[model samples]
Target chain A: MPKSVMHATRAGQPLQPVGRRRFLQVASVATASTALLISGCNKDDDTPSAATVDLGSGDVGVLNYAYALEQLEAAFYAQIIATPYTGISAEEQAYFTSIAKHEAIHRDFFKAAITAAAPGNIIGSLTPDFSSVTFTDRSSVLSTAKTFEDLGVAAYNGAGKLLKNTDYLLLAGKIVSVEARHAAVIRDLINNGDFAADDVVDASTGLDKAMSVDEVLMAAQAFIKEKITATNVGK
Target chain B: MNLFHLISQVEKLDPQAMDQLVSRRNIFTQLAGMSKKAALVAAPLLIGSAFNQVLAGNKDVPAVFNYALLLEYLEEDFYLQALAKPGLIPTGAPMNAIMQIKKHESAHVALLKGALGGAANPRPSSFNFGAAFDNYPTFLAFAQALEDTGVRAYKGKAGEIKEAGNPNDYLTVALQIHSVEARHAAHIRMMRRGAAGGGIMQAGWISNAEANGAPQVVYGPGNPATTFPSEGNTTQAGLNLVTALGTTYTAAEVSEAFDEALDEATVRSIAGPFIVA
Candidate 1:
């Protein structure tokens, strides 16, 4: 399980709610601070809240979800570029630079588009926690890159069905492929022939993995500081 | 509520629920036999394959799916033929990557045929690979083009598939397959650039329609310029990405950021020369 559950309940309550108080607390806090905890709270403990954001409903929610992912990816690549891991080849450095640019563009594109479409609904700039990653080690860096890239692909694949707008679906389609390409390259960097391994691509179906929104957020929760609620996303 | 959620619930109960139904070969009769709640719980799982069988119910989806199958067949055939040649691919890393890609293409072919069932298009008997088999670099170039085209083709069809079904989940399936093609394309590009001569130096992602030595037709605008723009397109959703953000990004970087789709007509025209059905 991810350190935190991205699905929301009421602030100061446990991950699951018990009664009308939970619903009432959630409603009262919806337009307030919206801060929930990122650290794993006990199943039944009444926890204090901090650093949380809610991905709103419908198309705006979907865009915010995408934006949240882009922010995570862009931050990752930017960090990779900022401190090149030991023994990183010149070629790998150059490739990382290009990838950083692509991710940054994706992040900024979502920001601009969302601001124009629904300024208030756009998600805030997320704070990434890359403490788990060892920037000094090439193996650690590339492996983390592989994880993020694969996660991005699966998230987009799963999210496609949730999109009500075809244009947004197409846009997601465009970016997911690029993320897949990144995933492939990163995998190859780790293991020359493991670009599309059986783990990532189903041996029986030949399709890449499609993770649900909750699943994606759970997987990504460890890398982020802020808690996120995607319950209303695509509803 | 989406029926897919129910399907997920049923899958949790029995992971092979759809497969068992598929083996029975009378999904509709079976669904009809079940109680309405059970059928409601099972319909989305059935829709994955039966939706194609229900071709008469929706022409648009089958047409788009068939086109996808055709492209998969083309790619599978292309990889199969190239892999068949003795020593066409290098022995170490190159061979390993090609073999992996070949397996994936074959898997994609199997998945598409399985999904489409009787409606699936038959594979072409012959292929005209010209100089692709003559040298390793040439093979890589052709492989890159086909993989890149596959990515774009699937992207182009997303709208078609999304519009056709009542949450058929084919759109998600197509998206799943779409990313795998991109992975293949990037690996092929890696192999090309790693070649000793540096003759086919290329980025893993498309950069300003740079075909390197691959077919130019794969990168240019398709039938209608508006719908299927060139791979070098810098503008997305009406804003030039390079200038959209306050930060400065080169046009090449902006273009490399997002891939563009090609219409089905243009994709068929590009792949038509090699397929001899």
Candidate 2:
């Protein structure tokens, strides 16, 4: 196996020789080019930096894009459960905890699957700041949960079609369904019995609204301190 | 070898050689039993090998379908379990509503199976509902898990239909099923909370303000935006009113929540096996 393939396997992603070869060459050139360009360019700007991982072109990019989002979520929930909120009610605590466990399992599972199939292109860790979150208050925690859950459903809805691989597409479907459940529970927690009202879903299209990668990443940037970019995504 | 060379070798080869080459190449001229193109692509790899094992023995189907079937079974069983329990449906109105939901889930199971078509595998005789319903805590946990799965499943498949380039008919129906599933999820969440009312908020936003008044909003009492903001009202109706009153949360807040939930790793883990198939 090539060094790139070995790196991918180590990262727990599937090894796609063709994709791997292309990714290595492209990534090396892109990184070198980006570094050189950055040295010459102005650093101050309000615009969010593009994702570092080039997701490649077409559906593969979409899958990798989706993968990056899942990584962020898994990390967030892992942290949430690792340190339970200060004054969590029993029911509320358990609910969030189970979600955390589920998210972690999902994260690991994707890591393994991607390592096995695509090989060597897993995006790096995302640093999240919970400084704004008052984990002690039930309202604060649940509200945060609601925000994450709702955004997840929309992100999946938006990117579902961009995937080229039928297998990856199927996997996305399964995960999105779970995200919807999280959204419902969190919504209800904020307001009693308000799980699927017109607030989260559209009455006219009857479809969950979608967010582009740019939109989703911008929103997430607040929580993450590191400058992140998507490479080979939808390339 | 180049693709053309491979194709030329197969064309010039004998019947047995052709068979070996085709199998080796993993290319199918026509999927034996599937009618739809997408199904043809998926069937040869998924149902062809795994279907027999699932049928011959009691093992679970491969990943995506396995999870999908499991969710369908859970939803089906949840309704049965809820209906079987007493005090879940109090009096005429609630009972009627519960019955409607039950019927819808039954239809959902049917449709889910329909998507599987002739390849529809047999249902497992029983499932471990886990510790979800042994008590309120367990029940809430299970309900959350199932609802979350359902929402993602629909969202995930919607794009598949579009990519197949078939009329959006199947996608439309799936979305419809998803909306109902969303309703089911909302209802279950209410039940988990032991709330008495119905028509809780759905998962997506409704942009139309004229037909439906401003969307309901919820706020933590700290903001000096409106009256009784400090009450921490947990009622569905109250939250809806508050959201409509003014936007307490930014688009970033809403979208970040979504990103956290729809993380690519999580979705891939759940659907990886099926997609690879």
Name the best candidate (by TM-score): 1
**All DockQ scores:** 0.60, 0.05
Candidate 1 CAPRI grade: medium
Assess candidate 1 and give its TM-score to the true structure: 0.81
Q: Distance (Å) between predicted and true CA of B232, model 1?
A: 0.6
Per-candidate iRMSD: 1.0, 10.9
Model 1: TM-score for chain B: 0.79
Docking class of 2: incorrect
lDDT of 1 by residue, B1-277 (tens): 4545645643453342455435435777889999999999998787655544333224566577778888888887787888889888878888777777778778878877776666677777887877778888888889999999999999998987777642346778889889999989998898888888765667789999999988999999987887788999988888888777864798899888898899998999988988877
Model 2's DockQ? 0.05
Q: Would you list the C-alpha lDDT of every candidate in the order shown? A: 0.79, 0.49
- B105-219, model 2: which lDDT tens digit per residue? 6655675565444445576565444444454434544554455445545545454355433122344455445645665554554453453343323223211111111112211
TM-score of each: 0.81, 0.47
Give the CA lDDT, 0 to 100, for residue B125 in model 2.
Answer: 63
> How well does chain B match by TM-score in each candidate?
0.79, 0.47
How displaced is residue A67 in candidate 2, in Å? 2.3
Q: Candidate 2: misplaced stretches above 4 Å?
A: A1-53, A230-232, B1-163, B166-183, B189-277
The sequence of per-residue lDDT tens digits that candidate 1 reaches over residues A97-127 is: 9999999999999999999989888988998
